[model samples]
Target: MTTNDNPATRSDRNVERAGKLDTATLSDALDKLGINGQCYKVKARSTDFRLAGRAWTIKYGPAANPPGTVGDYIDDVPEGAVIVLDNGGREDATVWGDILTEIAHRRGIAGTVINGICRDVALCLKLGYPIFSRDHWMRTGKDRVQVEATNIPVNIGEARVQPGDILRGDADGVIVIPHEHEDAVLEAAETIHHAEEAIREACRGGMRLDEARKQFKYHQLQTRGK
Candidate 1:
């Protein structure tokens, strides 16, 4: 059967591709393609963490009269999907914490990213469950925010993320790959990765840095196409 016929195979391939790329190289590719996929301000709770997977987006809004749950959606997230939480950049409350982290880790979910804040940092770090967000706080989002929707378009650190979009994060930060541009972005990222590697090798082999960079057209790698 063709790869497209197997969802597992496709997901594996996407994760593998994303695993090989860092946010820096991916950011350059996005720049060249004129796509604003770089998530600003959002950072990993620990530099030791890394994440790569398709997005399972969740958007949050103010809770209703009686308030609502903050993280009942964990059980429904498919394995290998990055849980992208858009809490409207709220810093006062957190949409994630120890319970969610524990469950997500046990379920083999790729990771979690939030535009707002998250609590329970110690648990995530201990479990090596990657968590990226604006920052970590002890406040709970219980009665303050509620899940507005799931598997829907959401914004994280100003970057628009839609369900199934590829997200890759590292010590640098996270970048979203729109599903429609996945192929192009991956291709560009691979090309840039190889070129940069070649430049590095040439420099190590005694070639001048300037000459190597120029030979690889380094300065133009991230330039917007005409």
Candidate 2:
């Protein structure tokens, strides 16, 4: 079968499974699995938005030798991939703005995550497009910072995101699930989610909170190994 028709070749299954989960649960799963995928200091523009998809990584660095462009890579991004930008965590300059937002929105791109900052906050909020970043500012990155690489592994907050890796983000935060360990991570996250639900139900059924937690092994839920 063709690659497009082959479910095994696509990240649809993993993305679908992770789509149901939040960053919190996914973080816990990553922790349990001894994987460092939780991003730090990254907050969503709107807590109402959540995104899960393969990563399209972009790395940025200080401009040099006449400088490079801030954007221009959005056009090459595939549908359903999160635009992961590594701006070296510089909040002083913005790497994304209104024009890119409009284009990404129209193209059906999943979302954008930046280690630095983004401008045009109003447009992103109004369009309901998900943007997770250190902060938003008015200063532009043009001539200040430029694209150093595309589709390469980049650091987002403290998380190392590689191209094609699964990225799931929400109001809580963002987490990276390495492509090779997706199945294990998804299984662990789902297990943790169910266990938490069971504990909640048990408590509502008149069981003491402590007893319910103990019954469901809440402490061990996020603990590494069984």
Candidate 3:
């Protein structure tokens, strides 16, 4: 079939492709990408966050009135794909809980992120599920509700993620890569990482903040191939 003949087919192919990246690789991609909501910062004490092949999403909803069971939307839990949910930034009702977390892992999903809240903390931690949520809550989602139009666009915090957009999380926070800019972002992140590292080294060597900043200007300059 010609490319123009089957649009849906192409999209499915893309989702399949994006789901294959490992948690570490995705994180590195985002660390390199470096664009997320101002509040998209990580707060967990020690998550070691890396969720690879679990792709799912939700829309912004209310805690006073959340959507439904998120399990239904998770059709394909590609090994190492992290489940990315955007609960309209609510910090009360949990869109994901322990049972869902366990299932994702069993299905081979790498990790999960709730732009809202979650429950069953003990179970999640025990299951070794790497989850990053805004806070912890004990509310059930029976009447709440869920929304996942598989491989569709969803927003988390202020970051826009398309169907195949790469999602990554670390102790620092989550960073998303627009599918179109994945490779470019990855390359930029590498350049950024190196720049930050040099600055760190300078600081360790007893350089003051201003001195380190000035020295790193050269490193930053190099990122632009200057």
Candidate 4:
């Protein structure tokens, strides 16, 4: 839940706060805030893997006549940044694989997320590097797909994410918090988390489930704000 002060900013502070929370809580916060950041259909490689960091977005498109490359941008990803690859949800080709995983891990990269698929699943799993994606395959994306842009807005499982946006991922899924709304989202998420904890405490104390929920206003936990 801690972040280095290398380039600390308000968003970074909020990211650290959001990191302590699960995707479910942050997803509820996004709902309450009316932000469409819940990445539907995308999932983590393992439930045990978790990721939280600023996003370094990459957008991909079909290769041209001369063909294009897949993951050459990994060299530019900053330490602790989450590499988000937007491959248009293609499950046939993979933009990530064993080499990228090894290099990213060595560089202290937080994790990676993809709208398409990834190869070398066994290496990522063994290294315990978090990778959230729509699916996984062995096919290379080298000639099939090419990097159109980097540090730009990209789609991940229908969720549009911009560079520097806070990305929180866990067993539930990934959610992006726009830099401008990080403060509000973090605050709202913490409130929801605390309320849920209170409900748990009440239930553990023998209170009826219905009573516990009512006491904490569980029904309105995800209601949008004015």
Candidate 5:
């Protein structure tokens, strides 16, 4: 429900907007917060492409190399959006690459996270694209798989990502944070991150962990500590 209707009218994004998150920030945000309501723990890549977006998922599998490469589904991608591609755990076929990244980046797309393989690693990196895939492969999709639908429910491992759900990704992997919990998760995450930052700085300043915890109440809930 937090999905904005017009890009120009978007407000309340103080840090970085969801649609413009980079790999580091996306990862940090996920590490900072968690959706208390719902999300999925889907399959993903290690170094292929790292991405985050408002989840628009698709579930499909019937062949080794699935079709419906994400580029073909661009019409559905909103400006300043990230695309979460679910390939039903197929890891051998690659559906994303240089051309796709270029198109997406130019379209104001935030990034992409795939449940399968992605190609054009060097190209995407050069483009400063944030993409995450299960693996990289030279294989191409021949349209064997059909999108059949978009913005539909799709599962990633144990998580189900629906349209409007948040996708966060980084070197640690990707996580889908539900839209309903955005405010709570973001607020909690920000508090947790700030506390951790302070602790880290204190530790670097030669304070012992126990001493820092005693001074900052690190173990207690942030709200209570304040």
Candidate 6:
């Protein structure tokens, strides 16, 4: 229940808690905590896509002299972990494709968030595999890029993502909640969600919008505290 709880004990619970929250609410919580987690310009492949899980971070860079494999790390990713691929925001080549999507989906992997582009959009859509990325392109990254590292800290949408951090994505976008702050962020998000629901209920009961907002201290919900 506290932020300082052991991560091993809280990881599953935190991921479940994150699943019940939308990115907007989590983003608001991050704002209140003065954390930058909103993944700018990285959007879901389809508005229907949604996922929540611990991050399995990967960083990609230009291929070496021999040009290593583009995606040999997929097999090592654990189930229910969201693969966070940092490709330096490149759009010229894709680091993910249909094969990876099929394998990930079959393996029960939560989803994928790419700081670059992905290919084979149709397969992902068909499999109901969630993919949040800068864009989709057919161009392959085979000879252009290689996996520099795995399970390491990486940047996604200018937001630093560490291995085991919580990643929640919805129609709007993705938000990364640092593992250390998951408890606080989830608690704040729940508070915000409840407050907003209360406002909506009050409106339905004939209370003025302004009155409802004031009653819930809605305007200050996301304000950073001293």
Best by lDDT: 6
For candidate 5, which ten residues in a row score worst on lDDT? 1-10
For each candidate, what is the lDDT?
Answer: 0.88, 0.88, 0.57, 0.87, 0.59, 0.90
Write the residue-wise lDDT of candidate 1 on 1-226 in tens digits. 0011112113667668978999999999999999999999999999999999888888899998898777787777788889899999999999999999999999999999999999989999999999999998998898899887777778998899988888999999999999889888989999899999999999999999999999999998889892
Model 6 spans > 4 angstroms off:
1-11
Where model 5 places Cα greater than 4 Å from the true spot, the runs are 1-52, 63-71, 220-226
- For model 4, residues 2-114, the per-residue Cα lDDT tens digits are 12232312246677897899999999999999999999888999999998999888888999889977767777778888999999999999999999999999988999999
| Models sorted by lDDT, best on top | 6, 1, 2, 4, 5, 3
Look at candidate 1 and give me any clashing residue pairs: none
Count of residue pairs whose backbone atoms collide, per candidate: 0, 0, 16, 0, 12, 0
Q: Model 4, stretches more than 4 Å misplaced?
A: 1-11
Off by over 4 Å in 3: 1-46, 52-55, 60-69, 202-212, 218-226
Candidate 4: which pairs clash?
Answer: none
Tell me the spans in candidate 2 whose CA falls farther than 4 Å from its real position.
1-11
The C-alpha local distance difference test score for the whole of candidate 1 amounts to 0.88
Candidate 5: tens digits of C-alpha lDDT, residues 124-143: 77777777666678776546
Across 1-226, the per-residue lDDT of candidate 2 in tens digits comes to 0022211114478899999998899999999999999999998999987888888888889998799888887777878889999999998999999999999999888899999999999998999999999999999999999888787778998989888899889999889899999999999999999999998888888999999888888999888887
> How well does model 6 score by local distance difference test?
0.90
| Per-residue lDDT over 1-226 for candidate 3, one digit per residue giving the tens place of the 0 to 100 score | 0011211112243344434443334454454345442226433423655543323454544323444345565545455565677777776567777668778768766677667777888876777777877878888655665553444556666777554455555565565666577556556555555666788888898889788878777434333333
Candidate 4 TM-score, true structure as reference: 0.94
**Per-model TM-score versus the true fold:** 0.94, 0.94, 0.69, 0.94, 0.72, 0.95
